[model samples]
Target: MSLGGRGDLTARIYRQIRDAVLDGRLRAGERLPSTREPAGRLGVSRDPAGHAGLREAIARHAGVARSVRAGADDVIVTQGAQQALDLVGRVMVGPGDLVAVEEPGYPPARLLFRSLGARVTGVPVDDEGIDVAAIPDAARLVYVTPSHQFPLGVPMSPARRTALLAWAERRDAVVVEDDYDSEFRFGARSLEPLQSLDRAGRVVYVGSFSKTLLPALRLGFLVAPASLRAALHAAKRLTDWHGDLLTQAALARFMEEGLLARHVRRATRE
Candidate 1:
């Protein structure tokens, strides 16, 4: 929905509720709790450390420690994976810089790179994910959905993953690995993330809870190389000082208590 439409709906709902309460149609005292009382009961702070809990939760969920050897400091919370991509684009991409992406790929990503004044080249994908050979040497960033490729649902082969990393290393370029929908692998064993295979810190791993949990939550994170963390964090701060604290705190408790793992298992079964 557009922002204007959402605002109109919210205003309409509020007016309806207010009118009902003011009339005798709705019993506000019995139906609704006092806002002032609830406000006093809850303690809220705008600490960036709130993102730390979320970062840790993402690290545990994605197996960053064991699989990618990344620590909590490597993670930066974003509004969603889309924003994470935007931040990476802002940090690494410049006008006329080349960005290689799959031909039949995620449209928003392609649009995003273009919005940043990047020259996006579409590389074809077969059963083995994106054709690394098609990527130009001048490309500064390569965006890919390695696990369960978007629309096609083909996992990038281990050999392709290694070759992509090697190409990035040789060209001093960056690879943005969007591990979307990897958690729901139904049959085959999931391959290790490119981030895990990368030894030269060439991969920026991005993941989102929108697919696994709920899209309304709008929570996602990026695991970047130590060298890029400061710039990425600055980008995040400029974009939005931080994400929702209450949601992050609640999610932290959920993951720490093992509820998230249980939910994922149950979801997979169903």
Candidate 2:
């Protein structure tokens, strides 16, 4: 995939290697020069975690807005929320692993887990949210849209949130919290996200800017626990290396200047 950016020397070299691989000119298992030389020349290592500026902005904004506890290093930028889920699946799911999704949940997440060779099961959702008791014991990953239940639009009650986290800890499973569209709330303030409430670091909080910004921008991020950070970073590198740095830089500036919060406030009022 084209990591869209200005054609710097590094970008040109990356493109050459990419083209050669795609054209079958660079066969697998062939040794090539290490990247240390180019990395030294550029004065920056190839970081799969994504743009530093954007990750810092996301950490700062999410800390205040979502009550999420994280640092810039904990954030992994993705093409969108969908890609965040994909990376999580890549790290956590294996063939025949049990994966659970909320009934009538986000279809994309369900399909994603299934595509990763997981045995997907749907747990029932009530007004409070997905019934923690209904989740399978063997599930290795549970995907939930707790802030605003997908298709049902009900915020998970605080009690339910606590129960779900406890369940995850007891089951030794990970929870994927898709916080998509929670920024557009029109009623009471959103309950604490599972990420904020989690003490065991089992929640992978996934968020997207598609509702707040233009969907075509394809910006999103995930706040992963320390335990999964390395695996998630590796998965991201293998998937796309990184995203469009130019867009990430623009978004970072927008957030750092407080324009993003201002836009959200105006959107909420309207």
TM-score of each: 0.81, 0.85
Global CA lDDT computed for model 1: 0.81
Which one is best on lDDT? 2
Please report, in order, the local distance difference test score of every candidate based on alpha carbons. Answer: 0.81, 0.88
TM-score of 2: 0.85
Clashing pairs in 2: none
Ten residues in sequence with the least summed lDDT for candidate 2? 1-10
Q: Provide the lowest-lDDT 10-residue window in model 1.
A: 1-10
Q: Write the residue-wise lDDT of candidate 2 on 1-270 in tens digits.
A: 123344343465577678878998879998664787656766644758887778988999999998999898899999999999999999999999999999988888899989999999999999899998889899999999998999999989988998999999998899999999878887888888899888998999999999998899998999999999999999999999988988887788789789999999998899
Quote the lDDT for 248 in model 2.
Answer: 87
Give me the runs in candidate 2 sitting further than 4 Å from their true place: 1-45
Task: Write candidate 1's Cα lDDT for 39-130 as tens digits.
Answer: 34443223332355566667777783227556667888777899999999999999999999998999999999999999999999999999
